[model samples]
Target: MNPKKPPVPVPLLMVIGIVAISFSSIFIKWSSAPVSVQGMYRLLFTSLLMLPFARPYSGAACALRLKDWLLLGASGVMLALHFLLWMGSLNYTSVASSTMIMALEPLFIMLGAYILYKERNSASAILGMAIAIFGVVFIGWGDIGLSAENLKGDMLSVGGTVAVAAHLLIGQKLVARMPSYLYSLIVFISAAIVFAVYNLVTSTPFFNYPAREWGIFVLLAVVPTVFGHILFNWLLQYASATTVSMNILGEPVGASILAFLLLGEQLSGLQWAGGVLVMAGLGVYLYSGRRKALKLQDSLPNAS
Candidate 1:
């Protein structure tokens, strides 16, 4: 018999990982701190918390190429900006709208991969992305007409999505050349420094937050930033980027459910339908991409 296949399906692991990541938005919304402070502390504590676990310097004596270092730094900066925009969006928009719009990052990733890396995009992948975009449009329609605040939030959410896609593309390039933990450490540290400086320059009062807000901030750092992000990165070792992207479809579902339960946010019929379309599109994209990856792997020569 062929050697036993890996126990867990990659797609399933990715779904679980993304589900954990989905909790992030809810925590951000629940925290009483300002968005910039929330972003700042989340990055700060996550970097600090992960240091003991990653112990990245154990292997840092082997210097990274300048290009690799630049890529890693860029990824961190992009991530910082992504959080700044995404968390800020929550302050102005419905969590549902922000989550749904951010779900489009996968589509942006696909487009970026095709354009920048010349990765082949199958027709099915294009179709799936288009369907998902349509779904996002449908979800945003009501909010589009509602108020300027919602519209501004929607724009910020979209900007965050673009930044996240850029992060993924950069990550795909960098992770291949460095340890995942090391790359994560570099990115987190860089982001933390940037946020810290921004917090200081703006004279944001960090220590003035109420105990409850601080508690939530600490929980946010531990749960979503540490547990969720590290798990997602670890899963990348076993799963293709496209597979992970597919799993991200669950984020909106998880976030929406949490919002409804915790904040009593009601979802309209059109929004639910749109969510289904997004899920279906992601499903199709993953299926097609995984098959392609398997084929490519099979065609490669095996090491003796």
Candidate 2:
């Protein structure tokens, strides 16, 4: 008899992560609180929940240079900006549009890397960029004709995309030095502090939120912020990053479906088309980068 097949952990974890993270937008929509209140507390609660676990790895993080810490801090602030804008966008647009915009993150990361790290872009990369830009323009154009509020929401979502792409790219630099756990902890703490101070000055009234809103806050912390991210991070050890990234493209589908079933949200034809184009462009962009990397690796002579 053949031995029992081993369990597939990477894809399993990825599916679970996708399902868990799909609730982030749903939870945010369920809340009636202001953006500042939701954004600050989400980070604050996630940070507090992660603190105990991060302690074990904090010592390992000390080996990181000051530049690494600075980068992590910047990433944290960028994360705050993403939450501020993306979470707010849900109020103005359908879940499908917002989640579809989130998938454009890879394209934004390409731009951020070009500007911040001065990374060279391939011809395919440029082509992919053009396509993605056109898709966004198409989406926004349709939104403008339909409702200016939608156009505003799309723009805000795009802004949030840029922020998150910057956060991921910056964190990429630091993760080479320290563990992801510690890096996540520092960034979460820094983001929480930034949001907290902003909220305090703005008087966002974090404590007076209803109990149901508080439960949503906790769900945001545990589901997407902690569990989903941690699962993806862990799966990285078993699967190629490329595979993991491709799987992340499914997030919009999962989220959109949940929105449809649970929130009774629907998307326009333009939004659906834009989502397809954005995802196609991103897939091409990532594939091109991989090809370039492979070609470079092949050109390097074997070591003596």
Candidate 3:
């Protein structure tokens, strides 16, 4: 008889996912296609790749109510906007600046939760938000001294982060009632449709890209969308949310290293200082938020 197989290593897979996602900026920077076109093809390819696995959750998708469908559409639109803005940022700013600004995503999500759901935050979380904002401002100020174009890129990156936070907020509502795979599939398809319509209206040529660009699209789909995000989500079943959040904090460091190695990117003193501040703030923010959540969970009458 064959020997029994060993269990999968969740920690190793999480590291793989982080590494895969760290390539996102590098691939986007390499593509010369219009941001919209790239976003469209990436989502299209991602949706196609996910279709096979999402089949098990098709029943859940089909059962979505009208409100759920509408919210899903909104979520998709936000995702498309995020891709457009974030990718567009690459044209103007350094990867270090862009990724550092994006490191504020958890803060944005926290603020969104407070605004929309009345979720209160801890004092430490607020302090973390302030520190992170200061870091962003520091980076932005440095960019302004460098060139207005760089500043524009930083702003666009901020907008993109906000858009993604909105996407997550919408997902938080629906994921409780449906499979995450189904939620992700519907959102990806919706974003693809949105991009398809935008491209058609703008008369953007879809198939005019060279082979290299096509490969980047496929890599974006397979590496980040499938291996990075999907794998991370799968690992969530085993890891604490705190562990996952902490791991995500490593992305900027990984991406900056990759950018330096692959694209000959370098950070200045100001950028380095600001980057450190940003990561520090994000770390505090995530830690406090997770602690609060665990406390709340434990306080409940039916505490696990």
Clashing pairs in 2: none
Indicate the residue-level lDDT of 254 in model 1: 73
lDDT of 3: 0.74
On residues 1-304, what C-alpha lDDT tens digit does candidate 1 reach at each position? 0122346876666666766787898889888777778887887888887778765456662668788878888988898899999999988898778987887777777778778877667888777777766776566555554688988898998899898788777877776656667777778888877788888999988787788888888888887776666666655555544445555566776787688888888877777777788777777777777676677667656733
Q: Residue by residue across 1-304, what tens digits does model 2's lDDT show? A: 0112215634456668878878888998888988878777777888888777776785787677777778878988998998899988988887777776776665666566667667667788667755655554444343343578887888888898788777766666665556767877788888888898888898778687789989888888889878675565444344323333444455676677688789987655775676576557656765775576567567666633
Query: Which window of 10 residues has the lowest lDDT sum in candidate 3?
Result: 1-10
Residue-level lDDT tens digits of model 3 in 51-162: 8877678778778899999999998999899888988998999776787677667677766767776766678977876776666555534444367898799899889888
TM-score of each: 0.89, 0.77, 0.82
| Residue 223, candidate 2: alpha-carbon lDDT | 90
Q: Using TM-score, rank the candidates from best to worst.
A: 1, 3, 2
Runs of candidate 3 with Cα error greater than 4 angstroms are 1-18, 129-146, 229-250, 273-279, 301-304
Model 1 stretches with alpha carbons more than 4 Å out: 1-8, 238-243, 301-304
Instruction: Please give the lDDT score at residue 164 for candidate 2.
Output: 75
